[model samples]
Target chain A: MRHLASILLVLLLTIPSSPIFSQGRVLEKKQVALWFGIRDITRDSLANTGDLDFLNYLHSSDDMSEYQYLGVSAHLWFRGNWEADIKVAMYDDFAPNNLNIKAIWLPMKNLGFTAGIYTYPQLMNEFNMFHRLTDVGFFGDTDSNFRQRRVQESGLTAGLMIPFSYRWLHATAYINGGVSTLSPFTEKVTQKMINGNFKREIRYSTSHSPALFFFPEVELGADCFTFGNAMAGIRVRASWYTVNRSVDYGRVTYEWTYANPARNEVDNPAHHFSKFEFDAGFYLTW
Target chain B: MRISTDRTTRITVLISLAFLLKAVSSCIQPVFDFDFDFNKITVTNLDNSDVYVMRNDRDTMYSSAIAFEVTLSDEEFLAAGSLPKAETAFPGFTPATAMSPESLYHPRHHITALRIVTLEEMSPAIPAGSDVTGLFVAYVPRYSEGFLYIITDELLTMINRDFYPGEPSVSFQLFCNQDITASRVLFAITVTLSDESMLTAQTGIVNLLRAR
Candidate 1:
């Protein structure tokens, strides 16, 4: 993945001068046009309301926090009809464990249809240290100590992008099939008092192998306000559920893990993602 | 003027980027390592019953069993503690489950051995004297031994290794004589680690009433 990313970076730097997209309309004002689109999400990160079993399981931990992203987009100074575009999203707080980059081409301006390659890093919580945190009362002594390292299970994204921008407005429609990984939360234990001794009857733990978190979704982005080099608007994304069905993979069942037992398995009937979310944001270019 | 405006915009962008980088760096924290002790015990009441009844379930059967479940820590367990209803190690853990058994927490390194002493606290309201002393024996009942606690070494390590969930109760009942109409019996388990090294605990007196 590191080599692939390095190659992509080299390609991004050389794409503007490359013969492939070096063809475009010669502008009357300037022979070149270089603009950058920036979107900052750290200002606000509304939580992903305990939708997936994984997110809900993390709500009880002390290490839980909101993750942020700073997205950047660069449009090349290619001539008249052809242009090279690179979009990158850098994720928060950590050094640089997460990223989303897409390099696209627009054959022509207004009413243009484009294709792009997408890549993003994924994270997984194996939950190996959950028991230690839950059993902190053995000596009437409790410790607020808990921590876990996340595992990355990222995969590339494949999709079709239809971008249409007129005089003062811009919109893009996307139908993307992205791959991810999911390990539904699972653990079961029965406690008994044998001759006054508190003993545990551990019947289950999160032993099931993670299932693929692959889903197809439609996303639409539109910019309503456009000033000289910046545009502010809201984006909407619609997608089906993505949790692995109980029948397919064993259901995630437990107490003290979640509030509702009925929410043990939030699997969707149709093969889709467990998230049906709506994200509204901006696309500023300068 | 145009060049000046561009220069100012560039400066603002640089400052913003630097601040964002600072925030990200500050957020980076090393994973915490916790020192945890795993010695624990858990108790369960099968049917949530406070009173256990002697099951004749058969004509020749004079045997009985304790409804309460006392399990020692195997892999996951909460040790005996004085926790209020509002406070809990985990959710759904009530005071009934948090309170240690009779003398399970017998401070001062506890006892070298555990001895199960059975005695009748209350007897049925009758006119003549009733024999309630040796009605039943308090032992760690075993299915392999036809549900009877055979006299043997009562070491803390041995009890911890044996008593757990799904297995028969270490606090088991045997031969509830047909004569005893009603009585409150205390099957007390006494213990602490054989060697007062690190772990030490004493059993509390458990009150079980017999109902034919």
Candidate 2:
């Protein structure tokens, strides 16, 4: 998945650099720029499990609440105030954090409106294994095989971006929405085991649905000249999104006896979430 | 003027091509291939009293004693049996109306009723001209608790002449509530020949696991 996103970013970056877009206007000032930044992200949600103990085990050792990123942007100017721009960014965690390709029209120098495909970051939980607690002290330990469930948001996003400025301070706000597809689908999970020479399969009926989300973000910052035609700035952003109501995609387990059941069936719950994030970052553009 | 027109044409073609590629990729379908060859069936003839469960191989001997160890499900019985919903609701309660016409028309002792098990498959190897009119499944849940599930001649004919090489085996329905959770389920064939000779066969245990 990460590799696919990287390939897309590479394609977007190389397209404008080709002679295909240079048939008319040669090159203009500030048409190309590179940005490097460090960011601190504080994401919180009501439905999300904020339990540090659980998250501690899920995240890798290198994963942090803070990360760094680099980005490349290309702008193609057309009829006067009209422009087409594409920006792609990659984070230190090997995730493609941003990809926005849109047509920008600035009627006035201080304000511009844009619309495009915008990709961002999302968190998910993947269930990797399960075991039944039996009276014989967990029937068939270690030998039992593991089943995996990958949970993610995979889809196309269409939204709008608004950039405005007040004197030396610049602010950009974006609203994006999309529907999920093909990613962590909630479906039945089957676990098979061999007892003696015969094979037995126990299937768990699970359900999961595509996520519908609306993400809105606002960032404020000031740019100070670092070198000729190059500038650096620090910004603070507030971001929030709601992941719509998901279907009942939970796994159920049963307590069994060699004869008849001494007990009953048990149903396991699924995870659903929405989140809010605050990020402070410094970016150098040259 | 010509250069400007050429640039406009190039951009138009590029955008159209991009949309075409997106449409093609979006049509890609997910491939699903699962292994379905798993369950095994073995028959035990009454003639071979020492042999409990014999594999249905090509060289296997034909036996009048047809033993079938079948795992049944509550849903399958409720769906296949001629019993009413209100009657089957009572767990362990055997109903009188469970008999299908196939069982009632038996030439010998007419099978009064059917039980929980539903016959889904049969081996094609039964002797050509034997009277199978009085064959029915005798389902024994446990040592003393049992019931009779009659199998029609039409269903019996589907069985192979003998377990031929690569001969597809038959199967029975499994229910979620009744069969999977039941303490034990037993399925056997009791054949009363036209000459009054009787042969009975039983199957190996069918492992029925609960779904959901």
lDDT of 1 by residue, B1-212 (tens): 35455888999999999886665444332222211222433333332111222322221211133333333332321322322223223322222335333212112222244333444333445222333323323334433231112222432333443223332223332223223333333344333344543322222333344324
Q: Residue A282 in model 1: shift from native, Å?
A: 3.6
lDDT of 2 at A19: 68
Error of 1 at A189 (Å): 4.9
Tell me the spans in candidate 2 whose CA falls farther than 4 Å from its real position: A1-4, A11-79, A83-98, A107-113, A120-160, A178-188, A191-212, A232-238, A247-272, A277-286, B1-212
Q: Which one wins on TM-score?
A: 2
Q: List DockQ, one per candidate, in order.
A: 0.02, 0.01
Candidate 2 share of real interface contacts: 0.00
Predicted candidate 2 versus true structure: per-residue lDDT over B85-126, tens digit per residue: 231232232223443222111122212222323232222332
TM-score of each candidate structure, all chains considered together: 0.34, 0.40
Query: How high is the lDDT of residue A253 in model 2?
Result: 32
